[model samples]
Structures are given as structure tokens and as C-alpha cells.
Target: MAEILAFAGSNSSTSINYELVKYTASLIENHKVQTLDMARYPFPMYSADEEKQKGFSNSLIEFKGYIQQSQGLILSVNEHNGNPSGYFKNLLDWLSRLERRFLEDTTVFLMAASPGKRGGIGAMGVVQDILPRFGAEIASTFSLPSFGQVFANGEIIDQTLKEQHSEALDIFLQKLN
Candidate 1:
């Protein structure tokens, strides 16, 4: 079975993106899904001076190890002002420092969600383009727009959106096998 690591790019305790990622991960069959809450890891802002003074944090190292060990990754990004949340970006910066090509060649199922109609598309688009340069092999991508209206009771409410998500999930699962 594929060991998939799932996480949201936001550090909010009640993040919709985290809920979306958890739901998507649960749909996969015959897989061990490990979910990460970025809030649990307290990381200082990335700065060259900080790096030179304090070196890498243990949490960053541990997070990197999890990424390295996982067979696949499921990431749902939360957009903050048309960009990745500060928490997620900081983690990415730290990971890049650890390994310039950290996600290189790793299979990733990318997704995003937001309360707005655009569904965090801006952040998702940026990630889709930039992640590959850092070594992520995107297997599939999905977006849930107007998250409050489309998701209910821990599942997708709109039939059409559900179908679209299912299709994306199917593709991601195929890659896992």
C-alpha cells in the first residue's frame, strides 16, 4: 500500500483547506494516509541571519524526513491574499534550504480551497508552476471553490463538484498503485 502524506498549507486551527485535504485522503483505498497540521510545528521566520545563527529547527528536519519517506503527497493549499499562507511558505523556505530539490520527482496530488468563489486558484496556480521546479511530479490537481457552499457534513455537497473531485482522486490513486 502506498504511504501518502497529507497536509494543508495553512496553519489555521480551523482551516477549510485542511478539512478538504483530510476528506480527499480518506477517499483513497488501500493506502496509509498520514495527515500533518502545520500549526503543530512552530517555526521562526526564515532569514539568512537566523539560519546562520540558529541553524535548522528540529521540526523542519522532522517534516523533511516525513516528506522523504512518504511514497506520495496530498497537499491542499489555503490562499491568503492570492498567495500561499505565511505558515506554508515558511515551511517551504526551510525545506528548500535543507534540500534545494526536496520534492523533486515525488508524486503529489495538489488541491486548494477557500470560502471565496475562485477557490484559492491563485495560490494553487503558483504552486503548480513552482513546485515542479523544486522536484514535485504532480499526479493530479483539484480545487473546491466557495468551500462553505460546496462542502457540508465533511463531504462535498455539490454533485458536480463531487464528480470532479472523484475524477481527480481516481487519477491520483492510480499513480499510487
Candidate 2:
């Protein structure tokens, strides 16, 4: 079976972005989805000094392994101050240190969502702009606005939003095949 790595960019225990990623993974067919929590695979706050002093951590090695082993990715990021949350940014930094094109040619389905109307669009914009540089073949992207109103029972509830999300997921899955 094809494998997909699904993750949220937030370390919050009750992360809505995590819920969104899990829900998105559920929509995929014939794929084994491994849901990754940034909190579980913790990494230190990245810095050039830290890299010079200690080199890459074991967690970062394993994290890169997960990315390399998977054929596809489903990710939803949380926004903080109009950017990706700090922990998520740190993960990216560590990953870059390990391999510049870690996500090269990997199919990616990117998403973002929030309680408000803009949905985590700011963070989503950042990921969309940067992932391609890592050689990510972005298959489709979705941003869910007013997440509290549109999502419930572990799934997207609003009809129009659900349809739109489903369309994007279908496009992503098609590209995976």
C-alpha cells in the first residue's frame, strides 16, 4: 500500500490543525496514513550555533526518515503572528539541515484552517511558497475558514466546504497515482 505522512504544524495537544490533517487523511483511499504530532517527535529550537555545537538530533533523523519513506504528504499548519508556529518552523529548519530537498518529488496536499474567516491563510501562504523549494510536488491545497462552524464530529460539516475539500483531496489522490 502507498504510505502518506500526515501532520499538523502545531504542538498544541488540542490542535485544530491536527484534526484537519487527520480528517484530510481519512478522505484518501488505499493509503496507509501515519499521523505525526510535532510534540511527539520533539526537536530543540534550531539555530546555527546549536548545529555547530551539537549537530543533528536523533529525532530529526527519524523525522527525515518518515518524510523520505512516505510517497505522499498531508499537512495543515497553524498560524502564529501571521506565520507558521515557532515549533513548526524549527522542524523545517532541522529538516533543511539534514537534506535540502527532503520532500523532492513527493506529492503534497497542503491545507490550513482556523476559527476565523481567513482560516490560517497566512501560514498556508508561507508553506505553499516554501515547500516547492524543497522540491515538493504540491498536488492541491485547501484552506478552511471559520473552522468551528464548518467542522464537527471529526469531519467537515458544511456542505459547500465539504465539497470543496473533497474536490481538492480527489485531485491530490489522483496525482499520487
Number of the top candidate by TM-score? 1
How well is each residue in 37-155 modelled by candidate 1, as lDDT tens digits?
Answer: 87798899999999999999898999999998887999999998999888888888989999999986588999999999999999999899888887988999999999989999999
All candidates: CA RMSD in angstroms? 0.9, 1.0
The CA-based lDDT of model 2 is what? 0.90
Q: Relative to the unseen true structure, what is the C-alpha lDDT of residue 168 in candidate 1, on a scale of 0 to 100?
A: 91
CA lDDT of 105 in candidate 1? 58
Provide the TM-score for each candidate, comma-separated.
0.97, 0.96
Write the residue-wise lDDT of candidate 2 on 1-177 in tens digits: 678999998889889999999888777778888988776877889989999999999878988999999989999999988898998888888898899999987999999989989999999999999998888998999999999899999999999989999999988888998
Off by over 4 Å in 2: none
Q: All candidates' lDDT scores?
A: 0.90, 0.90
Report the alpha-carbon TM-score of model 2 versus the true structure: 0.96
After superposing candidate 1 on the true structure, give the runs of residues whose Cα lies further than 4 Å from its correct spot. none
